[model samples]
Target chain A: MEKIPVLKIGNLLLISIQTDIYDSQGLQLQDDIANLLQRHSFRGVILDISSLSIVDSFMGKIINNIASISLVMGAETVVSGMQPAVAITLVELGLEMPNVKTTLSLEKAIQFFNEKFNRETDQDGSSQE
Target chain B: MEVLKSKTLKISEEKDLLNIRGLIREYAGEIGLPEIYKVKLLTATSEIARNVLKYAVSGRMTIRILSDIYKGIEVICEDNGKGIADVDSAMKKGFSTSGSLGLGLPGAKSLVHVFHIDSKLSVGTRVRLIVWRK
Candidate 1:
């Protein structure tokens, strides 16, 4: 089975979906992300789907599941880079993935994670002091 | 209506789903559908195609380009499997027998300009989807 690569960078896993993934591939990605989060101490996941031109109900479901699983595994998940058309279709399809956080671009997602975790760490450090 | 071009493709495997989307995109471009409408058509086609794979195990799709009163694309998906029992309930949101989100049929219908479905208990199911150029 072909696997979508999950790259680790500074306490986060970055997955850039450069192609329209198959349904099984999406399921596999969810499993892979869960495994990575469980084994590694990753603080967040950034899923870049800007390259995906269409997001149907199944793909939307798979993404929602991934975000939920990542949350359970103690990692925040942000899906970024949705094309304008894709966003419109998602709404028309009524797949409001309320649980998943989204950003306009991968850069913003990374910044979001940095700020989030940094703030948490700051709080922890100050509490300790 | 005049038929410009027509093609048929088998939809059995997961890869076929991607193929169908690509084919729809190509045909929609050929017919001069707007990019956003193209995405809507592709997404709707995907939902129905995935249902065919999940329930019937396999199916076939026919893509036809039409001209005349409505310059549009029509897709007919047919599958020979245990058919849907209650289509009305099936169309309702958040209804699924296979533990899915049950959004495929309704979501697909919402995206396209025209939609139709037919099914029988011991026979099979067929769904017709169409999107027009605007």
Candidate 2:
């Protein structure tokens, strides 16, 4: 049973799925992310799925669930690095993951969270302390 | 149709889904399936293969590269468990009995160029998925 590794950087967690994970593994990942979010004060989660060759309806649902769970735990989720072919297939497959936010690459995903948190900090005006 | 290449795989567990995807990718590439169609076929294959494990508990899949007037790949998945009771309803979106999103059958059909399903209660189900190089 291989577990997908989750790395923490700053206040965000990065989960780069590098293998063609099976159904159980995807479920395991959802559970792991939930547990991590419960234990940490992370503000965002970045999921990189560039290595995944296919995103079927099952996988699509898993990803969506991850994003939803993260949101409930007070963390935003950004999925990045989807291959062009996968993009086309996903839409054609009728799995519009409206709940998940997506970015084109890791840089964009990181930048997205950076700007978002910065804006939040500025709005609250508590980071000056 | 002419059979360019063919292989058989068993779908008894979750890991077999991965193997089905891998084998489909290989044959799709070898047959020069365009990137978009290749991805479509692969995704459809995964959906159907996973269905076998989820519902049937065990099954067999056959991959074939066929050429008649055009080149294409075909996958046939057969399961021995109790077949789908109402395939028409099963093909509808958001009609899942297993608490899933219920997009497996309909979504798989939408991805490929050709899709066929045959099932009988108390017998089994056979789904045929095909994508052509165009």
Candidate 3:
């Protein structure tokens, strides 16, 4: 019954999945992210799966679903720090979660999001207030 | 098959799938299977285990170590649900009714050396996989 913690920083949400994810857990996370998006305004979500050693097609689908859901709600999702074996398995499994973007490291992910949001905020007619 | 060790696990819930993965990793590693093979076995088991949870809502998975003319590990997953109507089509990528990517059975079969699946209408499904030590 472990809950994956979601943290809010500025205009983004962060979730670090370090353990094996269950079906309920994955569903709960999708719901949590969606709920959080409603109560607050965010532009992006970053999922850190560096500590994860295994991932299957179901888990891959969940990630795909989350990214799509976030996209519909006006936020993009960025996944960082995937293990090599997992990447190989995901490719071999043929999961094409195109909406979910990937950055090799946390630092790069931060920079990527920072530049994206900063550009949004910089525009005079932007949605952000 | 000369058995070195074996254990049976239940895949009746969401959490059980994760535990089964951990158990498979431990047992497979204990048998000294290589890292890549370990990952393949783990991924293959995850696929079938998730299928059991999705299609049947519950099932049993047995892991056994074999040592005779061939040294390796074997995994069997059984479930009593609406049996796959057409395994040939089901095994094809992108063929799924449950909103999945339909990569479970096919992805699993490619990871191991020996694979077999048997099921009947309204009966159940039994998938067997064996990966020899190399």
How does each model score on TM-score? 0.97, 0.97, 0.91
lDDT by residue (A5-113, candidate 1, tens digit) is 9999989999999988877888889889989898888988899998989888888988899889988888888999999999989888888887789999999999998
Residue range B47-75, candidate 2, lDDT tens digits = 88888888889999999999978899999
Residue-by-residue lDDT tens digits, candidate 3, B72-110: 989999888888899998888888888778899998887
Score candidate 1 by DockQ: 0.89
| Every model: iRMSD | 0.8, 0.9, 1.4
Off by over 4 Å in 2: A126-129
For all candidates in order, the CA lDDT equals 0.90, 0.90, 0.86
Best by DockQ: 1
Q: To one decimal place, how large is model 3's interface RMSD in Å? A: 1.4
- Model 2 over residues A1-129: C-alpha lDDT tens digits? 988899999999999998788788889999999999999899899999988778888889999999999899999999999999999888877888776889999999999999998888888897566
Provide the TM-score, chain A, model 3: 0.92
lDDT of 3 by residue, A54-120 (tens): 7788788889888998999999999999988788777777777799899998778889999987786
In angstroms, give how far residue A104 of model 2 lies from its true place: 0.6
Where model 3 places Cα greater than 4 Å from the true spot, the runs are A119-129, B68-70
